[model samples]
Target: MKYLIFGSKGQLAQEFINFFEKSSIQYKPLSKEELDVRDLDKVVNVVKEYKPDVIINCSAYNQVDRAQSFPEEAFSVNTLGVSNLGITCKEFKIFLVHYSTDYVFDGTKQDFYTEEDLPNPLNKYGESKLLGEFFIKNTLENYLIFRVSWVYGKGKQNFLYKLNQWAAANSMLKIAVDEFSVPTSTRTIVEITLKALKQGLTGLYHLTNSGYASRYEWSKEYLKLKQVDKLIYPAYQSDFNLPAKRPKWSVMSNQKISKILNTDIPLWNEELKLMVREMDI
Candidate 1:
């Protein structure tokens, strides 16, 4: 099967490329500059030209706090771009895989959210992602939408990178204990997504790590792994006073994917350990 991946420069996209390269599948990875999704004409033309069996859209505007100030740009890239991709994929009868966020929910509920839960986004970024989800569901029948939370991995500006940077520069790190979610590793997401593609799975699925943790808890554990004894302070959301409203508890349950694939995903701590080993930090 021929797979065409968008946002080839992203960490998740890179992991997908690595997986595809090792597997028997053939793939064509394209960066944003290579195939600008914002251009509807270019997106349509590319799909028609490649005629790939699968289209994995890893491209997105993922700036949560910045989206508050630039909602239009976020909407243009996340919502409109996804709409164009969905239309093109539907026209070609290709399988579309889209990545969504746990921010789509308001995070009022204490329990872990399932795929059946209704989305009530509180911020602009979440709203834009939800719009993309709506477009894909309504426009394309063969689509797999994976809504993940607190994604961190070998990325340029992810949570882990920020934490490492802070730990390196400062003796003490102040992290939020109020906000909580399962920190998903990009490696796990790539593995599960590849398995789903091989099995031709469709519809919405919640893909996240096995456990949940707050920013403070995750930082504490990560710092310990890094052999740093810096005092990690736990603070509430009110202390930071960010422009965007974050979900208090947006941990997602991966039971649906596990039940379908008959496999178990590693816990967040275990995944983090692997990541730390890879980074040698």
Candidate 2:
């Protein structure tokens, strides 16, 4: 099957590329510069030209704080861009695989969120992504939307990278203790996506490492693995003074996915160890 992947330069995109390289899969990767998703005409043209069996859209406006100031750009890229892709894919009968985030839900519920829960986004970024989700679900029949959270891996930009940098340069690092969610690894996400493709699964699913952790807790684990635990300190969200309001509880339950796939997700600590070992941390 010919697979076309957008957002080729991102960490998840790179991981997907690596997975494709090792397998016998035929795939094409495109960066934002190569194909601007915001332009409907260009997006339609690219879809027609590639004629891929599966189209994985990894491109998104991920700047959470900056999105507050540039809501229109965020909505255009995350919502309108996705709408264009979905319409084109629908016309050609291509399987559309899109990634979403747990931020789509407000942190009002104390327990883990299920697929049936209604989305109430708290920030512009979340609102934009939720809008994209609606467009895809309404426009396309052959599609799978995977909602993930707290994604990190050997990426150019991620929480892990920032933690590493802070640990090396500063004597101490303060992280938010109240903000909580399941931290997902890029490798796990790619593997799950590939598995879903193999199984011909099509629907919405929540994908993340088995357990949840606060930003402070997750950072502490990373620091411990790096032998820099002493340098880290926990602080409340109000102390950070961020521009955008984040969900206090973004944990997602993967019971549905596990039942469908007959497999369990790895624990956050186990995946963290694997990541650290793979990166030789």
Candidate 3:
């Protein structure tokens, strides 16, 4: 199948490229500078020219704290941009694959969140993403929406990269113990998404690692695995005092996608270790 990918520089998009190249799949990747998803005419024209069967959108407005101050910017990319892509895919009869976030939830539930859970976003970023998901669901039937959490991969826009930067700059760190979610690797997401597409699966599903962890736990494990010697302390989410109000617990259950794939996903820590090994750090 011919594939067209947006947000080519993103961590997830890069993973998709890596997989496609290795598998010798036909694909065309476009950076935001090349083709912004918000431009319907451009997107439609490109779709007409490429004639791709699948459009995997990795583009997003990921500035969580900044989104609180400038919601319009967030909505423009996450909501409006996605809506344009959805419309284009519908018009051309192409399958669309988009990624959402666990932030869609308000973190009130004590258990793992399922697909049936109602979303009540606490911040503008989450609201924007939730609205984006709505646009896709409302616009296209042949679409795959995967709600992932704490995603990290080759790109520097992830928690692992931020942790390394912080460790390099500071001798001590205080991570939030209250906030919790699964740290999903882009590799896992790309692999499973391809499998689902091959099987003709089309719907919304919570895609994440098998297990979950608090920021404190993930940080401790990441630092240990990277062999970084730093003084780390666990604190409440409020201690950092960020602009955006984050969910205290946004762990999503992967049972739905796991059962569909007929396989158990690797644990978050295991994936982290594998990522670090690949990093050769």
Candidate 4:
């Protein structure tokens, strides 16, 4: 089956490209410079030209705090852009595979969030992503919307990369103790997505690692694995005083997808080790 991938330069998209190439899957990867998904006319033309059976959208506006100052930009890419793709995919009868985020929820739930859970986004970034999901669900029937969280991989855009940079720059670090979510690896996302596609699963599901962690906990584990000697002080989310308000407990449950795939996802720390080894860090 032929696949068309958007946002090829992202960590997640890069993982997808690597796996698809290794597996000899036919696909065309496009960067934001090559084609911005917000342009409906261009998006339609590209889909028509490629005629791909599946469109894997890795495009997203991920700047949480910046999104508050630039909601238009966030909505343009995360919402309107997704809407454009959904419209074109529906017109072409193509299956769409899009990625959402855990930020879609407001973290009001005491336990893990499921697919059935209603979304109540706290920030503009989250609002944009949630709206993108709505557009796809309202427009298309055959689509896989995976809401992932705390994603990290080969690129320099993730939390792990920032943590390493902080470790190198300073001997002490302050990480948020209240912010919580599963640290999902891009490798796991790509593998599970492929499996789900093969099984013809079409619905929204929370795709993440087996467990959850606060920013402080995650930072400690990562530092321990890398043998970094930095002293990390646990701090509350309010201490940072960011522009966008974040959910204190945004962990999502992957039981829905895991049961369907019949595969248990690796723990966050285990996946971190694998990623570190793979990156030769």
Per-residue lDDT over 85-133 for candidate 2, one digit per residue giving the tens place of the 0 to 100 score: 9998988899999999999999999899999999999999999999999
**Ten-residue segment with the worst summed lDDT in candidate 1?**
149-158
Model 3 clash count equals: 0
lDDT of each: 0.90, 0.89, 0.94, 0.94
Per-residue error (Å), model 3, residue 256: 0.5
For model 4, how does the per-residue alpha-carbon lDDT over 156-262 read when each residue is reduced to its tens digit? 88998999998999989999999999999999999999999999999999999989999999999888888888899999999999999999999999999999999
* TM-score for each model: 0.97, 0.97, 0.99, 0.98
| Per-model C-alpha RMSD | 1.2, 1.1, 0.8, 0.8
* Runs off by more than 4 Å, candidate 2: none
Candidate 4: residue 260 Cα off by (Å): 0.9
For each candidate, how many residue pairs have backbone atoms clashing (under 3 Å)?
Answer: 0, 0, 0, 0
For candidate 3, the lDDT comes to 0.94
